[model samples]
Target: MFPDHTSTHADTAIAPGDDTEHHEGNPRPRAMTSTAEIDSTISHPGSVRINVKGAFIVDSTEQPATPANGNSTVNGSYHEGKDIRLPNHTAVVSHIAVDIGGSLAKLVYFSREAHSTEPGGRLNFHSFETDRIDDCIDFMRHLKDNQLALNGSKPKDLCIMATGGGAFKYHDKIKKALGVDVLREDEMACLIIGLDFFITEIPREVFTYSETEPMQFVEPQADIYPYMLVNIGSGVSILKVSGPKKYERVGGTSLGGGTLWGLLSLLTPANSFDDMLEMAAQGDNAKVDMLVGDIYGTDYNKIGLKSTAIASSFGKVFRMKREAEDEAEDNANVAQDHPQLDQKVHASSNNATSSSQPRGLNDMSSRFSASDVSRSLLYAISNNIGQIAYLHSHIHDLSHIYFGGSFIRGHPQTMNTLSYAIKFWSKGQKQAYFLRHEGYLGAVGAFLNRQPQNWGRRGSFEGDGAALEDRLRARTSEH
Candidate 1:
């Protein structure tokens, strides 16, 4: 289960040369206005490593005046050959790509500060809720417009490459908002390609997690092929990645991250998926889950089933309610002044039900504690997915299993549950590893699909081809 990690690193080549260029416009210097800070990592020219400590700023001082209506002025106001002085007097060359999905829209764009002193290119990653796609469009449009102003060249007609369900579902909306043509990419292809890039180029981008042992980093091997990828996004998608641009949808499950969020939200007051996961880490699932010991009164050692093993998730609720009902019935038969009966009735209904049945056919207040419900639901889905993934891996003889998607998000319990399930199922034969940027694989895949087939092994993005040049383009002025 991949939760939501957002670290992104890009390999870029900044054309090193003189950056000073003459311009014509002589408008008065406006006061520098602060803008929203973007989190980005720039790789040194021709380097694969990402320098996380260095900051790359996209100077917003050159933005056009806010229109009277508080909107970006019509594209007509922008004309070719207009010298808009950029910060450091260097042109910023950026190519933008995106993957818009049911829940989130991911963006991976490259930018280079036009000076040799700033040697590398900046690869910035951004995301927005799919419902707020307009925000994504606005951000891209601003970048596109800025790119135009920097070079005094007409915006290139590069189609914005995209993948995921939203690519088709919201095509027209994106086209209208950004004025850029939308190029659809196969979702599976995007995922595989993105996985390839992470495995091959990004260092320390994958790792294995287990509760018993400390988290260990899984180094990406040069010959690492034929691994099973279990992506837990809204739903799970299992792929057998044989090589670059080579994969097959071997198996999947409908109950994935979407299930966890949808189900847990109903039982808990958590306002977000992260909040639910945090609550789950503190939860004691033993209170809500029926364990083997709870039923047998001892370890079921004959079958090798531990006493602490879960017999039925959320199973204790029914048993507790039945016991409460029995006590209530017995109390009715007893005298009204029977002090012991009153105490038993009150204790069973108040304490037992309160702890066991957080939400049931009874009062809303009877709903299970957020932590317990969260922990149970998290395990329920993780175990289910992990078991299925292991079974598939066993059948296919696949040794490696890398879990990616927005489900694990580096949550210790979720990863531990997934790792434990795989370990238990494989019986020490295999383990579950996770990606650093589990959430952005689809978007990264879309970005990589624009590259040539053998581009991954070359370890360089230039000269082989202009993979993104065709799709990562600016829209033309309609008027």
Candidate 2:
């Protein structure tokens, strides 16, 4: 629901004045080059948020070189430091993290005021977005050319943090196209890692309701210890996150963003997922939705079921509307001319304008309005998911619900609907915790893969980084 993604306010901190030193030893400072000379058609700093499925942000002010240039990689590069000290080195890394979904590929990179060799400076992160995978590949190649074309900037070791179904299938193409290695991750694991980080790190990124204005959720002192993680992606995947590296595949279902997107795509004239939601906002489900009265012709008195309940799924409303728009034109003209003064008379006739579906599902191509379809779609998916999640929480006897993935990028109505559903279902016992950087969970994992908890106890995860550090030493002969 949080709409104003003002760059003025991101969840990052440099501990003001904490930055002072560069790497203990490194090469001569090179002049920054003009990316303009390289190619001018690429977008820098990718996506601020992932789509409906659990994905990561790929928008950033960073770019990779083109393929023809030879060295410039599209995904970005990676590097290691001579010593595992305070400041880290990653300038050589091209693309730090990435996730490829059915229709989109996300790229994330870190931005440092000084080189990664520098001490403590904030890493301004961003991502890239594209409907087609080829576009992303071209982008990485462009970035490589631009970086190499720089006066002194050299290519760095880049690790491709990839997830989703395409990760395994597209691994090689990603590697060859970007000229980098893909660090494959468990789709669910990435979700958990992302959940843990969001719960533990950023304050105010999450908000829970109270008697007063919603409190900007502060990270509980030990929030990540254990929680039930529900990743609402292309589909839903639930996990019981025990710790950073310890989580279990708890439960999930087919009812997910894909379901909503798919149904709307076929049933409504809606184009994008956002468009579907816009129309649904004004659409009365009574038109298409099956009602209880249509079944028993009365309330299920024994169970206290309302007479107007949804008895059967997809049982009614095939035409999805009572009357077509073209037929209603005559009535509108007569009503406009009369300008009827009787309020009661107005109620006598079923006003077609107030109660009518679009002429037909084919009308989707008619036009795209700044519609509320996005909001409606969000509610249905979130509400259903929330109810299902609440059921799981109740079944497992879990308390905390950590919602992670690309789909929950601060969609307010979705969050509100979900939170309310959880409250209604749990009677206010359980709460749904969300993260700000919803999609980059896997990329962050790939970034933190070097941590001891990950890459096994010996910690080979940081090898790419470490090897690069050693190479730097051999060349510059610096400490």
Write the residue-wise lDDT of candidate 2 on 131-212 in tens digits.
4566666655655555443212444544456776777887898788877667677666565555554554334444563323
Candidate 1 lDDT at 188 equals 88
> Alpha carbon lDDT of residue 254, candidate 2?
80
Judged by lDDT, which candidate is best? 1
User: What tens-digit string does per-residue lDDT give for candidate 1 at 90-177?
Assistant: 2223345687766667777544545535444444556666667777788778777766543333345434778889889888887887
TM-score of 1: 0.67
Model 2 clash count equals 63
Query: Which stretches in model 2 have alpha-carbon errors above 4 Å?
Result: 1-95, 114-131, 145-153, 209-215, 267-271, 274-377, 450-479
TM-score of each: 0.67, 0.57
